[model samples]
Target: MRPRSVRARATLGATAVVATALGAASFALLGILDGNLVRGAQADAERQALATAATAAGGGLEPVLVPGRGIDFLQVVDARGRVLAATPNLSGSPALTPTRPGKPGTVRDTWKRGPVRGGQRHRVVQVTTVTGGGLVTVYAGTSLRQADTADETLKAVLAVVVPLLVLTVALVTWRVTGWALRPVEAIRAEVAEISERDLHRRVPVPRSQDEVARLAVTVNATLDRLEAAGIRQRRFIADASHELRSPITVLRTQLEVARAHPDPALWGELVSGALEDTVRLQDLASDLLLLARLDTSEPPPDTPVDLAGLLREEVRARRGGPVPVEPDLAGEATVRGSTLWLSRLVANLLDNAQRHAERRVVLSLRVDRGRGTAVVEVRDDGPGIPAADRERVFERFTRLDDARSRDEGGTGLGLAIARDIATRLGGTLDALDAPRGARLRATLPLAAD
Candidate 1:
């Protein structure tokens, strides 16, 4: 089957609806007019019959016997069933009996012998006298031609008007659809003109506060996000390349220096320094790769996990430390997530706490009663992060100025990785200001049945 054009489909549907409504209205009007016309014709025939009966009853037979202009036939019968007078055409028939006297009666008797042009169905009216000896009847009729003619005329007009109406409606619908979609077409053309090279360009926003305007706003917002993501991707690539180049250059220079030096110990020391740089570079590259995968990968695996148990295990694993460790775990806090990733997320926070705490580190995991959220908090007595640098510390490769020396041996990606994993699990990781030292909290959604 051939596919139908959208414009044609829209126009056809609109036309069909309008035509159906018009057709129904016309049919109802025609029925009412037909009923009224038939009723009026019946009333006129009855009036003529009444007048004829009255005239004949008031005088002798001659006036009633004469053929009246519009009256088809007339007959006067006495109470004893004798015809007083009738028109020539109806004279041969037997004298009519008074079925009802002194009152009106109707019958569907035929009148072939009338002065009317054609035989037709008619209503008969009877008149009776107070004296029991006499009665009068009058007959009048109309040909069905007038009613037939009116019907034919209506049919002919409808034949012409209905098709014309359908055509006019189809045209109007087509024009209206085109007018409605004009803005959408313009938006499509403008969007086609925009490419990666011209992301600064935007589609024109329509002034009207309609659905089309809302659609345009949504499209513009999507475009803005794409542009921002593209810029971030370019920056990430440039930064990665710059970071990788430094260690590579240092390794190459160290190798060259060792090749030129004759002292074995000096050469060994240079080699060891190069090895350490190589290890650091490797760790940075691995962390970057992991961060990239986390951003782009699907949702984490959903498995039953006792979060309190996981925290206790992590705390026990780090039993020996410069700082005293205390853990407060309560409730059966079960969650759904990748165990490996969740362990890494928890481990990163604990390691950061251990490295910076002055004397004590406290870890706690429990479900918050009011909010119904699973909260895991790690606090320490060490110097806490300053308010100005708290947000910056979660970014990749960001380090505190006080801990920038090579001896720190941190890749500065620990908090970044932890935050990314937390986000993927539909949780939040944030630093909280504490009186003694820094406090970090990870809040996860409570598992719902």
Candidate 2:
């Protein structure tokens, strides 16, 4: 699964996204924080100016103002910019920030270092009114010290908090990613422990139905196949040992007998028998070698082949034996496969049929265009195969009758080799029922356009 890469990419992407979002949000918060603080102070100054203008409109404008709650300075002035009323602290002072608009609306400005108590900074607002005594204006202001202090305090707090939040998110992302990849690590470690000698061992599968769990399952399936192949290999080795020993023992015994007797007349007879056994051993070795090649080698390139022509050639080779062979050669049916191996498959089937036939054997080749396959049928008028043992006959080294002599029984690899070759060519060989005997039918794919 290469879980480290998955984890690294996931953590990096998540951290980058969160960092960008939090950074943007932090900047927006800082910009809004100062303005929000200033808005409150300006709103207070506007309200106080409105109140002073209303008082002057009611015609009882006084120079000395009463104590108020919010504003630090308050003054009422006429249209010509003359101070008509003032706060107690500025009883005789000029209008605060009176250089405002000349209409009956509000004008807001910043009160710089001015003639107020100690010249403190303030947010100033001017409100003008349409009165019978001409246009009158009121000026009111509030200190900026508190709003400025709070804005600075919040900026300092956020400078510390944003980094902490991003760090916390990154830590959480790393831990969660590691947790998700833990199962993959476990699967890798377990598979690493599996050797050829440890083929019986299996990797642990997780309960979750996620990608990692599926990966674990696929690895387990591959291990199962390897284990099964190992078992079959060991079994073949055991069977090969037993089969090889039999002929070698017979050859050794015949030689030993001839050596002890030293009979010139018996020499011919003993030599012939020894030659027959040697041939049998040779054929057995050849069959074993062919089977080994089939098992281990990569598939040979498939070329166009004439199945009917190949069948006729094989039938001709097997003629003049004890059994009279009949050929039913149909029209040309082309298929695609390795010529040597396909010929081996046909020869094996014919050999098997001739050995089992009583008096008659029929070899036929037909092509079924509807099914896109070429079929080869070899029927023998002998004891037919039982339905229960049909599939078992194709297994290597399996003989239905163990007591039968080796000559009649053959090497027990003909049908097995035939089936293996058929399978390698993407075809099937099956023992089917016949009228009076057994029929081995091989179906292979027809060469297409």
Candidate 3:
């Protein structure tokens, strides 16, 4: 057999259960009604027999012999199972029932098989009477044909009506289920039409604030996030390509010039210039690769790193730099983060400050034990960034004219990388207002120890 659809199967199963219940109930009701009718028929037969017996006793049995009412069988016997008087329809036959006479006014029910009445089933009532001579028995019976016919009619009607009712209910249930699922189907169709290339498209939310509507809203929100990520990815690619092209173009031009003129005197300067460009390109590519890795990298391990020690080391390492760096270390500042990333963050700030400073750069580290934070600030005596461009300074490849000149050995990605690394370590980096220069501050969560 072919498998049925959900609606069809549900309808069929429900209808079958209802039909079975109704069928059983119908049968029980018919049986009860038929039993009551049979009992009523027996009672009527007994009543007729009693009336006939009373007439025979009062008027000597001859008037009842002429046939009274519609009782089908009647017999009078006197103690020996011998018939004393009978209706004309009996034709001098024996007693119709096997019930014997007992105490006066006692009645009993019995079944009789008749010869003259075509052997049909009859419900017979036997009544005992005490007369002037001896105790006599009176039998009365009626055919069960009429009650049987009524029961048969009831069965036929129930058989037709129950199935009709079940079918009607099944149809109504199917239609209601379909109507409720209509919105879900619409959402499925709309979602099917969406593709990755058009993540800007959104699923339609129904007016009702039910589960299906909430699902559509959540799907649309996810699509919005994907669209934003796609835009950022495209912009990153374009910017990277533009930045990479500059060095490659310079390399190609310098190689072409060196190839045309093979003068030994120009070769030294050309090689030095090429080496510098190559180093700059390498540093830029490394920074870009680190940023890409950070996009998918797991959270850094939580290891206690002393911020004061790291700052001191960074300043000592840059001792040979052209600008003077003033260190203001207050206490043993500790934070929770990867030592490498935290060090890189500090180095980026120091490098930016060193590059922009004309005479001096200030490096400060302070531990706020009560606040549970480690704060690091690098201040430069260079022309400070404007208030309007403060937030934009941390964006990738964003460069102010005085801060990120080509001759200053700055790739314009240092601050961006530093901010990203700081965020990953549960810290924040921002530029603060300075009187004569730029002040960059980084705040990191303190280590438990």
Candidate 4:
């Protein structure tokens, strides 16, 4: 069942249980009331019967005893069960009850009494006393019809009212529950209408700051993130296609020229150009794949690697002319990271520095044992990057200078990859401001000794 429907049924069920309990309590109270009325009738009859017995013992029953105060019958009998005196209603009849002596104030149930037969039940009280030098018994009885009629009336009233009360309570509970969940139903409807393509749409928020409103806020926030991811994915695809098309077009054009000219020198030039474009294409495809893997790949295993030694080795392998590599690696600087990734990070930094340096590229590595960090810096003396462009330099396919195009041996992904790897390795890489040129610094946690 739906949530609101289940809530409605639960509310109805609880109200029904309460109504049933109240009905049962009311029924029990009625029973107590009916019993008390019958007891009061019996007490009055006993009092009247005792007075008649006293009268017969001292004087005569006909002058002292009176009837018809809610009592049905009265009789006096001697020890041999012969009627001595009785009210007019019980005239010429035998003893209504046995003349045997019983407890002083005991009431008994009798079915047949003093010519009144047909098994009609009556409440009787008996009193015994000495009269005319012999023992005599007095009985007073009353019909049970009035008390029984009252109990039946109460029962009938309860039977009608209890069900009506239960039904009314159940209906009221159902209506209240439905009213409470109306906002939740509205939120569900609004969210249901939103498709994947309509992630920009938000669920309607209620005015109250309850859980339902909070839920609407959370859902809308999730939609916002999904929309941003969608936009980024579309832009990434377009940029990748644009980057790939350039190399492929160049390769096709070079091959076509070689086919049409058929000159030996021109063939050599064409082959070199084609090979360079092929290498560029392969590198771009590899960078894109690595980025995709970085997005989903688990963190690499950590191991101790000498950061200073890695920097020194990358600097020594430099290919360009007139760019002197100066190293200021002070001591053993080791950090916890994957060796392959650390090597790539240093190579990317050195390559970027060598490309921009006029005549000198400086590499520095040091470990601050007090701070528990290893710092590596690559500085060059070429045109410095502006402060506004530092952060953008780490974004994919971003380049500040249009003159320094892809043909200038820069893929525009080296810094982005380096930053991503450093982050995964629990480190940070940033472009720091320098006096004359650019400085890129990487900080990583030092390995435990």
The candidate scoring highest on TM-score is 1
> In candidate 1, where is summed lDDT lowest over 10 consecutive residues?
107-116
lDDT score for candidate 4 against the true structure: 0.80
As a whole number from 0 to 100, the lDDT of residue 105 in candidate 4 is: 39
Q: Give the TM-score of candidate 1.
A: 0.76
Ranking by TM-score: 1, 2, 4, 3
Residue-level lDDT of model 2, residues 154-229, one tens digit each, is 7788789877887888788889988988998898899899999998888888898899889988999999999999
Tens digits of lDDT, candidate 4, 1-449: 53446666678677869787987798787879877876877887788888887887896667224575878788887778878777777788766645477433344554433244334456787888887747778888876666767887888888898878887878877787677678888878887898878878888888879887898899889889989888877877888898899889999999999989989989888999999999999989988987887677686658888787787777678745568778898888888887788988888888788777898988898788999998889899999789999999898887777467565767788898899888888889999988989999998999888
Query: Which wins on TM-score, candidate 1 or candidate 4?
Result: 1
Instruction: Tell me the RMSD of model 2 versus the true structure.
Output: 5.9
Runs of candidate 1 exceeding 4 Å displacement = 1-8, 43-140, 144-146, 149-165, 321-325, 355-357, 381-383, 386-389, 400-407
By lDDT, the better pick of 1 and 2 is 2
Model 4 lDDT, residue 436, Cα = 85
Best model per lDDT: 2
| Model 3 bad stretches (over 4 Å) | 1-187, 368-371, 402-404, 434-436
- TM-score to true structure, per model: 0.76, 0.70, 0.61, 0.62
- Encode model 1's per-residue lDDT on 1-449: one tens digit a residue: 43286667899888889899889977886787766765665566666666666666566446336644444566766555666667777666766443545554554433333344455434344444332335555555544445556777887898799889999999988998777767777788989999998777777778877877888888899899989888877876776787688778889999888888867889778979899889979877887888888979676778877788888788888888667679988776877786788898988888788788878889888797667679888898888989988888897766685354235557667888999888888899999888878899999877665
Clashes by residue pair, model 1? none
